[model samples]
Target: MKIGLLPLGRPTFDVPFAEEKLAAMLAALDATGHEIVGPRELLFDEAATRAAMAGLARAGIDQLLILQVTFTDASMAVAAAAGFDQPLSIWAVPEPRLGGRLRLNAFCGLNLASHALGLNGRAFSWLYADPGDDIAGDLKALLAGERPAGRLDAVPVATRSPDGARVAEALRGQKIARIGEHPVGFDTCAYTPEAVQALAGVSVDALALDDLFDTARTVPAEAAAEVRRAAEADVTGLDAVNQEELDRSLRLKAALETIRESGSYNAFAIRCWPETFTQYGGAVCGPTAMLGEGQVPCACEADVYGALTQLVLLEAAQAPVFLTDLVDMDAADNTGVVWHCGQAPISMRDDTAEATATVHTNRKQPLLYQFPLKPGPVTFLRISQAFGAPKMILSFGEMLRRPMAFTGTSGVVRFERPAGAVLADIIACGLEHHMALAYGDHRATLRAVAAELGLPLLEI
Candidate 1:
């Protein structure tokens, strides 16, 4: 792991102590088989700080630790970190002699700098100590790809261009636990147990709807409410439908959290289906949405391959991701309709204002979203295995708002293409007329994962 350290504040008069302290931290890092930077560079100069950050960004440092001394200014450092969007941790050391005036200044400045970083919404962990201890070791563990409790992020798997030998080698040994059965009549999306094993090195675990229901029964009331409030806050402009959606969204969110808490799962695939809607009343729309939003992506139709794709996306971006269905398609104008058992995170709505939640008892979890579809440029991607090969599809376009008469939350997406060639291409790809959609750009990161996996990649 490559970690960068940026110390913001005035220099301590004890240059040798500063040197020793940094060297100690570096030694601890080295013991863990990691690399460190800036133990020797005098970083008090503002330009020097900025240049270091820029260099770290270009060098592709995975984690950052900032040690604040006396200067107390954290704005510039925060700005630079924000630009890179990497994980950050801040450390505030107590003055060597707290009772003395100069010592007080060190503590005060360090405290101020950490506070500034927090106000900027930067994700950071703070350490307070006199000098040396297990603090550095603790940081090393955090950087060693540890997954904290209740924290989940998307992980990308590469399958761009594939070699028959590589595909077989990749699928020869892996397991994927799939929850629920596929949607009826949408048999195309469902995966056969053998197909999954042969093509992706995945062992499929089939689960019953009762499994989810049992998990929901044990959810604490408080946790359920918190999930509901968070889901409701994401919607701001719904008139009637929003309330219903919010009610159901909360139920699903709480239930999903409980499921993950009980199970030992690194990644999971789920079928948001008739059972979810018919037995549970509202479709598992909001919960499934939150699964992706929460970083544990659930693919519709019990598609283990799709879930694998979602997991890969989670690792690649570490942001809120969405798994959707290509319910309808319109090539006449290069447009398509994306909907499924609506389980995407409300936060991923992309709406500036809030919308109300609506509950529909007919489906799973009953939560229905009641906000305008975020209108803007967006990219769509789908990663799947075909004939023992990993495949990907990438496209971009605009999300159109539903008409006043449309029911539930629905929208049309118009993609740019040659006037008449769109439909043929879509069909040729054997895409299920339905696909997964995620917001924002992920080309570079996606490519990197693909490179690491030694697979084929296609960007359209």
Candidate 2:
């Protein structure tokens, strides 16, 4: 079979690591004795991807396999699926838990690609494995036109929480300020205002990313200093990073508070990405953590539904909630690692570790919170659009006492079920990558809330 391989990546991540992994992957594919067509180098943007796809189309490949080399938005994957008629598949490599940086966030790219393709009504197969692993069987299955399908289980019955009515009432008048649009091909962040209103009685207010930047610029030095002083109580090493950038990051907190108070918004969904580091010269992760600790949930990547999910969990748990990604899972240890760049609330920091001001692993901008999560019972929740409709997804787990799995805010969690089973369910269900995590067992309250909202509950 002739296979077309398109390698996608972003410059923000570790390009050297991606190149090494790409070379290994190409060598493994060559061992299969299949005709491999397309560029071996990483395609960093749409133009490169489109140009490569044109060549693959001319080659008349039987399958198109996307080599997700690093954490990239789903635009290129979606475009490839739209342009190609052949069967599609994605292969994302895993990085070791080096306790430093996430060298290649390929799995996250695959997760994003899967969600976008599902939303676009495109069918595809997926594989998460390292190049050195023996994946001949998996490769054969993909060549035989195999695809992963999520199995929907019956909603579980549980006792409703007495606070369900109050939580429902609280959601009625709440509003979320969505600053800027979600990144390209981030279908998981896509949401309909009417649906949100109907289900949660919440309103969404769209704002430009520049508006936040402008407000941040206007923040007086005194106000920023006040924020910095307040941060010193919970955070350490403020002066270790670039002082100018640190001041800029603190100003972002002041600016967000201004917008939140003036707009009467209960939450924020921010496009906290390339611009925050590339254009604004600071990171918003630290500011997001501060606001979240103050009960104003902030979702990254302008994920509106993620903010709403945080709100729901916050109401249910009545505590600080962290929106995180399930980065790594190990069946042998029955543990899965939940992590984010650096936006977890300071209150969730482990007792043994001090919350330190840090830089983004990839972007290298200051003002991100770095610490392991506290060990305790936890509840995971998401307002999911998987399967093309909104539903309630819940999971119960316990954060184990362990060393930090990787850089930024991360925790090792043991779910109610086996790690392998949970991983399989997550992939099969095509769940969104972001999950709202609140420390403590609030499963009952979440169930009651889901019941009150008449949303289907899928507990994995």
For lDDT, the strongest prediction is 2
Please list all clashing residue pairs in model 2, or write none if there are none: 150-428, 270-302
Which one is best on TM-score? 2
Give Cα distance to truth, residue 142, candidate 2, Å.
3.1
In candidate 2, what are the lDDT values of residues 1-460, reduced to their tens digit? 9999999998878898889999998998887889998999999988899999999989999999999989888889899999998888888888888788888777788878777787777888877778877777776676567755445543644556678767877899899999998887788898888889999999999999899999999999899999999889878999899999998899999999999999999999999987888999999999999999999999999999999999999998889999999888777789889999998999999999878888988777889999999999999999888868788899999999899988889999999999978877776666888999998888777888887887788999
Error at 397, model 2, angstroms: 1.5
Error of 1 at 51 (Å): 76
What's the CA error at residue 308 for candidate 2, in Å? 0.3
Candidate 1 has an lDDT of 0.53
lDDT, residue 253, model 2? 99
